[model samples]
Target: MLSITTFILLGILGLFLYLLVKYPDKSIGTNERPDLVGPRGLPIIGNLIGIYLKGFTNFNYENLTKYGPNATSTSLGFGRLIAINDPECIEYVMKTNFENYIKPNLLKEALNDVLGDEKCGDSNENWRAIYLTQKIFVKLFEEDTKKLLNIMEAKVQSGETFDLQQLFFRFTLDTFLKITFGLDKNSFADPEEPVRFAMAFDSVQATIDGRFLNPFWKFTEIFSEGGRKMRANCKYLSEFAYKIIKKRRNDPKALKNPKDILNIFMNAKLEDGQYLTDKELRDIILNLIIAGRDTTAQTLSWMMYNVMVNPAIEQKMVNEINTLLSNEKPIPKYEDVKQFEFVQATLYETLRLHPSVPGSVKYCLGNDVLPNGTPVNAGELVIMSAWAMGRDERIWGADAKIFDPERFIKDKNGLKPSQYKFVSFNCGPRLCLGQNFATIEFMTLTTSLLRKYQFEIMPGQKSPPDFGNSVTLPMKDPLLVKVYRRN
Candidate 1:
């Protein structure tokens, strides 16, 4: 008779053998074509161990560029993953054969656990309602911006060094809550206050990102400490969302006016001519909040970091803002944001280097070949690394790694690059609906802040902060900076 430990070891060995026999590894380039190159993987587990060891971001960068900017392949468990940094290949997956690819079920399940059920197919009415509501609330948004600016000004007067990333996150969250739900979180007013909702939101997003790498995350959620914490946070977030939704639904003034995005959704009808339920409304609002808040805040954080480290670039931006706006009305208005070309260029450059969402994963639906002659079978995962593409010499030329805003300025206007190449806002049918709103919000805040003050890196700090692991790219460490009134 075998002991308990021996029995456990024998069970593991038997499972490994079963997997190996059931799902044999298919060698790449088995046909007449050259093999797609990537880091070699072990049978069954494939590159999971490598990803876990090197860290996902580093592993992606090192392995994706091992053989230049072409598409590379590796196996994860029994599934095949092909990572593409080449512009043409990205276009092929994102645009040309768009219908042949979709968000993977595993990813959907992970997001759904936190974000609620994401409605699919024909959401035009819902989008239009949200857009119109946002347009109407532009003035309110401007007022909120002024309030945040005042907080920053107070910080400058006190001569305190604070994390601009944290400030941006708070500002966006507060503003988004006000505009979307007609509720003022007022996080900017009391910067030190603990924001449990925001913390929970971040934790859930990070946990969801981990789910992409771990196939057995469901089991882990039940047994692991981190996984249990994530589950609790998700519950907290859902309860908060539902509470706000119920309050809004009961408020007669809110329902009567329907000024905020939530009210608009509640009153709006679905494709089947039925009003959107509370659950659907909650999902839409939360999804929009995530979309609107983090992307804008993170991009602003990265943009400020870039400007501060490069004095020349910062000076150019300051000069542009000052020259464009009159002293009487320094803060940019909604219509005025479009005219600040160079300022917009600087924002574009920041996005180019540090896209908020560094990479996106798409699942192949049907067997097809990419433009570069890479064969992709049905049920394979195609990971597009915007981070890698942004730095690829083949796409952005020799100065790809340099922080230069001039790359986006052509003939005194913002140069438009191919959607497939500059995929920060993504491309094709799924292009970000909040692009205009985000731009206006960014420009408004940027112009208002830059006009009054200058940001300097805190003493003993370094440039180019390390990236945090999440669904989005955030600074691993706080972006501490000192704010000073411009002389």
Candidate 2:
């Protein structure tokens, strides 16, 4: 009787095993089987529970090891996500097959909300125009960066160590506004100025970060108070930009090409040979303001933070700057300032560690397979987490997370990853247009600030600012350092 009952139990167990294998969950198991395995997740939510509820900091090394080089997908509320660390695969997506991917509607709309433009409008052209305009103004910016250096020097001399990040934001905002739109509110000195368009731009960045957390709350116009404020700020930015453009248009001198971005923008003609409307002009200008201001400010903050943490890098930068300007005046002229090697290395390292626009989303314009054999369907969004890619041990070797500036000098093969793998400015046609402009600004601010003061982390102060792991990493509190004169 025992033998017969045991035989019956074995039969039932075999039947249950057969059902489990035949009818497995479809989300984790690919529709058409692929060469990758995703993290085991809740039936529908996948990685969403970890991203929003726990924050990225909570899942650092553990997640990467479990998920392989490319491990982000859509489940729960995350529409479509992809995190990549393979250099060969990233090269294919960003370069070899670049045309197949473009920024999606959701991203474009978030940027549009920041600039007060329509959701489905001709957004690409405006970004292109801004890129073209910044190319013209980069020369002018390298020229105007001296004034910002002098201003920073003054702040250093006064013995007031204010929030360096905020100060850099103000400086870059002033530079961008003046050079791009020919509107200068001088908000660097007075944060509460009525025409503080930079604050509006910051509001937009916050909204963009918020969207990533809870996508269900995505129709930002319907829910966010910050969104409403951003719209209002966009209104102010538009009016201010148009006022300048109208003034230029009425002036006879406007016919001639002036040396700034505003002149080129004013005189530009579209494919149809019609000039941009005031609304388009405003959107384009605001977009430039945010791109130019935020990227440079974040980079400068990161550079300073690294220098403070790694005293060796700071001394090297100071020595390089002093040696280059040794024969010249104490305040190095812009032409003379280009000779600093260590400073350049410091900037490169900072960009690697904390890229301002860390990661970006690329929507597949059509169906395509990445070099790593991951097939992306049309209309699907694939996100390249630049932050994750930078910190990957495979890419930068064992010392990936440590703040070391010398890694950029040379590798064993004497090849540089500056362009392909460590892509802060990105690569291919869609690369950052303001790359040179941002570098020059970072070089100038970092050198000038260090020349006047030697700063130390306050007692018990952490090395890098606790940025709370947002879309673009930012300081949880303002970066406050104790300052001392460079005697």
Candidate 3:
């Protein structure tokens, strides 16, 4: 005989079984997803949850290797990830149909404060601002570059183990400050005290990178520790940027004639004859400083490291520079740099292996098919890996992973990867505006340093490049090396 309690327990068990059959798992199961093959995860939650946790660099390599380098795409619970490594597909996305695939909202949220809206600046005003900014950097590169070399000489005098990456950062940052805002903060000379604003600027970027991992990151905007750091960083950097802008605005000489990029924007007027606002000028100069500084520094650090690892390459590069240097000056003249084939190739090989900007991310605007027949739906994030392509055996031959600069120089058949194939500065209309300026800066610094000194990677340093998570590719660990003055 069943008691009332017994009857109730039986009834509950029956209902639970009924519901299980009534509503089975509704998630898009393994191998049942739409034409996309990638890492597996919980149903409807996306296979990319773990990948995002790892990082974009890891996220790209895993997908490309699994789905074949020709093309790949996946849904990351929140948004879709579409990645392709083939040059034809890359050209299609970056060049042929550039207007459609723009920087998605998520990316903008991460970088808008630092990079600004004019990365692909197409308007007349944007063009003029880029033109004026380029002009200023080129004109000032010589003198400011000399200042940087002087600081490196001081480091040699001390002869203590030092961070090469930090020195590069100070050199580039100092150059940007003096060239754009006409402010000189000798950061390299005094490495004991770090700059507050620069520290904040870096913190903001790391937090922003965190946002990309979570699709529902907005929920934590005010709650999480990362969000708190981001808010503080934004406030601090904005204050610092605005202070510089306002100081330049009130200066009398700024209006009479342009002395820097800030002066150009301050004096600039449209056909109606009114100067750009303080906010507009501030964003522009800030964008230039943010975009231009870290990249050149990263490239220089990587190039120096590669030279250390490959002594033969270093001697070849030094010999080329020795032959090219003008008798009057100790360093190669500015125009003579382009003539150094091996020197240029060394830089190229360095970029190929360790691109400053490793990958490209764009949002698909419509249902499109890649050259490789991978279907990309609207609203999916289209990611392409320059890092993977730089190492792909199919594209670059069996020795693709070798650090050989001759691959870039005149080959046996005069064969070389096109800019579209090997894109460190990006390609098409959205191509890096500072490419020429960056190249000139890179070559000038490399020649100057090589002519005067040799860098030896300190013993006990990590071998496979340890990289940090940032918009720019910075070494994960500070590059510690000893510098010797060349005879």
What RMSD does each model have against the real structure?
3.2, 7.8, 4.8
Residues 375-447, candidate 1: write the lDDT tens digits: 8888778888878888888878898999999888752335677878899999888878778888889998898
lDDT of 2 by residue, 326-425 (tens): 3244444445545666677777778787877667778888888888678777766676666776788888889998888777766543324546678777
Candidate 3 ranges with C-alpha deviation above 4 Å: 1-34, 70-77, 119-139, 269-275, 326-328, 411-417
Considering lDDT, which of the candidate structures 1 and 2 is the better prediction for this target?
A: 1
Clashes of 1: 0
- Best TM-score among the predictions, by candidate number: 1
- Residue pairs in candidate 2 whose N, alpha carbon or C atoms collide under 3 angstroms: 45-76
Which 10 successive residues of model 2 have the least lDDT summed?
Answer: 23-32
User: Estimated TM-score per prediction?
Assistant: 0.92, 0.82, 0.87
After the best TM-score superposition of candidate 1, give how far the Cα of residue 107 lies from its true spot, in angstroms: 0.6
Candidate number of the best lDDT: 1
